[model samples]
Target: IQLRAMIRWGLETVHRSLAPWCSVDSIARHLVEQTESLLLQLSDVRPLAPNKSALNHLLATAGWLTPPLVDGLQALGWLIDERGLAGTAATDGLAWCLPMHELFERWVEHLVRLWAYPFGGHVRSGRTFETLVPIRWSSAAPKSLKSLVPDVVVELGSQTWVFDAKYKNHFEELDDQAWFELAEEIQSEHRHDMHQALAYAATCPASQIITVLVYPMRLPVWERLTARGRSVTVAEVLGGDRSVQVALAGVPIQLSHPEQTNQIVAAWNPLFSVGQ
Candidate 1:
């Protein structure tokens, strides 16, 4: 119902904008036509007040809102309680936006896909799934298998690296003491992320499995831990590229930077020779 109203509002706003433009571009015409078609399909759905206004304002913005609208719908769906009201709708607007973790995961996946080209590899999106531990069995077990899928898997030759982007602030302060004195809940969450990454690594048949936990922080930091001969890492994607020597387990990966194209290519120069 809410989705239909949002789309209807969008269609109306676009129609209004396109009406004044005497020479409409191909893109604007297409958008207007598509929205009209969609509005017809959603004629039966009714709109809710207050929420509709908020959604309309969001959709009236300049940039594309398809992805954000989808995200908001998902948020609204999950947040509705037994009483049919979003638990946090009155308190915050999160119910009308994408979950932070999902947003981060998608952003990381996008960056990894772009970066994979330099490594002569392709980033496969959720192509691999690992069966859950203590696998549940039923008479129709063949039809059902509990599985876990990593966010992105980068394959280069025989090497398979699983990248899981976790949008968590796992550290309290930038000090060894802070890490050692982490709160119990935070420690538990970190341990869970590590276990999940290890699980993904174990599912890979490749001899060299690199499991990296990509986290967002204000500073660029890197940590490597090895358990049972497997490499587990926590990599912080920083705000800006402060240095050019960004290497992960001796394999260089570029971070966010404005003037990084030539430098990134130069950094990959060594890897190119090794690949040959």
Candidate 2:
């Protein structure tokens, strides 16, 4: 398997060719070019045209880890419509697409870990196999759910924060609405998120648990919510000894200012304090 060469070439190709498809026009041109200089030294490895056939071949032969690397290429806009690989009508050849939920999870994990370090605790993530809990299925079927992995986990003394990042607009559409005001579909999905958070809390052993259901919010909207003291909604659940706190919060995804993200994360201190 030429997996090593393939991944290096793919990264360089993305930095060189498809970078424009996803580059933000608002960023300074010089800075963007400077970022390109940070690419891995791939002088000997020739560029690979990330076609579906080639990526598929690698996936079929390159053991288990090839999928994520191939996926990174797709995220970089190299897998455009029928031109590169077969895709649904969403691409439209001109538009760039990515699994925003996955991206949001990584962003949240990074931000949370930065703040978590001050607590003198270990930070873990599903991305690194740090928080993956194996499921014991009595009679496993073909392609059953493998593990219950919390997006981000932080351990602090007897308390733990299990964050589940969801990149949904449900807060804008469903938050503050009456139960009857929400559509059946939105209601169902919101409940599903809450249920999943509960499952994570149950699986993870902690005397005091904070199960955070985080969603993506625009910078302006997050600011508005913060002003009203509603950015982080804290609901104390499981009253007695095993105290569980269910937090419904939104994180600013497209951050405009540096302190804006810091402010959003700082609001979480109150929830962290609850466990202490």
Candidate lDDT (C-alpha), each: 0.51, 0.71
Taking the tens digit of each residue's C-alpha lDDT, what string does model 2 give over 30-103?
Answer: 43464455444555565555566666665567665556665664543443333332222333433556687787
Model 1: which residue pairs collide? Answer: none
Best by lDDT: 2
Off by over 4 Å in 1: 1-96, 127-145, 171-178, 219-276
* Tens-digit lDDT string for candidate 1 (11-95): 4544655544323234455666775787688788753322644544655662665786656543444333211222322444343
Which run of 10 residues does model 1 get worst, by summed lDDT?
243-252
Per-residue error (Å), model 2, residue 60: 40
